[model samples]
Target: MGPLLDDARARGRTVVALSEYGITRVSRPVDINRALRRAGLLEVHTQDGMEYLDPGASRAFAVADHQLAHVYVRRAEDLAATRAALDGLPGLAELLDDEGKKAHGLDHPRAGELVAVAEPDAWFTYYYWLHDDRAPDFARLVDIHRKPGYDPAELFLDPVDPYVRVKAATALARKKLGMRYRMAVVPLDPSPVRGSHGRLPDRDEDGPVLICSRPDTVPGRVAATDVKSLLLRLAGLDGS
Candidate 1:
């Protein structure tokens, strides 16, 4: 693989390297939605064998993933009470306000009004209900749809169920990136591994091909594109 990449670079092809996020060993898991529910800011219900939050009645709630959680408040009038409830909660580092949102490049419509950053030693969990039994079967079966946020646990292959190799591939294909990107779920044939999720398929596969809108931004290659864009945007010189 290294030799192939080197040959590509020698041929004047560019490359870029990036990751979705970093991982760490968490000492404990913090369920922010549980805290909100206990404070009477959020509501949970089990209907149709599924446990989910009642978004209409909730004042504030968090959609959590590994180390980050996006908290959405239903009413602006209840923001103060919601903050008071969430204040000093365990595993919560800081809540991002408007300034903090802008500092973190998260001041966008899709982002939540308040973002929760977890402590380095603690990770966020998407468990809203206290009892696991009351939750849906998918909750324990490595599902991505029932949970509001991302779940890295779905990367693993279930030993009991060999058919569903890529657990989260179905959900990620439907809900992630709003279908802007293509997803490929491949099985590890002749290998010890079961399957992999969210990967680009091999060139031989058939279907609509995924094309990059900006082909200039290549991997394994470093350029001033990011820095220049940031500087120009900050200086009000970039149109966007």
Candidate 2:
């Protein structure tokens, strides 16, 4: 179990598991406009205008890749602690290739190569890509589910039901929120959202999916150049 799970169990409180993206985002909202400075548990650094992870604070998350994802504790002080962790996290660059090689038994060579350019360990938990190491491992998911105050029923989503579809959508929503894809608990009991692929005539599927939350989360797919500009300029990439 993670630190948060242990803490929740020790305190005899139900872990507010993030069963979907919406629940996780609300629990750890991502303020896109805010640049990460200091992470509560991790020491983040920048050199030559490039951000890097302080290996001291991050534990190599086990996945197909060795340095697949990072495991860090969420701070009780601020929800933005996660945001700070996300923004300051090291992007996949070869700066630490030698150090990364020290780890064995991961598909990092193959999978890492694909994602190391755009996102490294930082994007592992956020998006479904090469580094999504924390995703369900049938072997280990039970310990995670059986923890105190956890409801195992949240694991499965019924495809035909809209309520379950919303739970499934939670995965995407959580990614947009930039929280490590963990467990979530929906506030209401089965108030499902539509799982319709029905596209709006005006909104092309190629366009960025626009989700209106408190700050209106937007995830659009554009050219690499456009993505870079948005991350670097609009999102304060240098600062992060």
Candidate 3:
């Protein structure tokens, strides 16, 4: 917890947020209107003008047109907008900060950074659609989705790993000009062991992905992903 927070703080972020809020906050609403669309691994949308979805976000939930879904917040302007929308809640900032320290640890760089700029509130609501296995079932993506007339219902969805994307987000915010935040989750594969010059440590209060320093994350493993890659991929630079 201490190290991960140290890492995040060293870089900077608002707080270590879980992809859970960004992904599944309001996805599985008690009311869902299925049969909206198909064939989209990702569905991007806007709710009250906020970016709502990106790659790995679900389409089965008909997120393409749903006003309830959410998307990853990348840019500072966008993040600021989000923080604004979340106003009205009291102590959200402190709670997040204390929780952050508790979550990331007292000395994580990422946590330190997040505490520096964290707000007192984060809008909360119901969105269950975000939790429907954001991670792809490699087998299904390769076999079932490729097969003719694959049944969406029959297709096996990989369990959601909200931390992977959130961790990446924290890392990206770290490289930002001034975003202090940390993310709590089980670190992604291709651990920093081989990438970060061996800064690998154990779990923190944030649920694994303990911060340390700039990860020397290897080029491949899925867990090795960071915000730079995720954002660039969103910008259509995956092939590069």
Candidate 1 local lDDT, 36-71, one digit each (tens): 888899887778766777888788888885667888
Pairs of residues clashing in candidate 1: 15-218, 15-219, 15-220, 15-221, 16-218, 16-219, 16-220
Question: Relative to the true structure, how large is the alpha-carbon lDDT of every model?
Answer: 0.62, 0.30, 0.30
**TM-score of model 1 (CA atoms):** 0.62
lDDT by residue (tens digit), candidate 3, 1-240: 778777767767323222311111111111111111122222445444333333344433211111212223333343343334333333122323335446534444422212221121112112222333432232123233322121222222223454556665666688585766433332212111111111112222222232223234323222433645654553457896
Q: Candidates 1 and 3: which is better by TM-score?
A: 1
Best by lDDT: 1
TM-score leader: 1
Cα deviation of 117, candidate 3, in Å: 15
Candidate 2 structure quality by residue, lDDT tens digits, 1-240? 688667866876433221111111111111111122232333334544433344354322111122133222233343344433444434332212324434422234332211121121111211111222322232122233322112222344543445645654776688789966633332212123212111111344423332322123234433333444544543345674
Q: After superposition, how far is residue 100 of candidate 2 from its true place, in Å?
A: 2.0
TM-score of structure candidate 2: 0.17
How should the candidates be ordered by TM-score, best one leading? Answer: 1, 3, 2
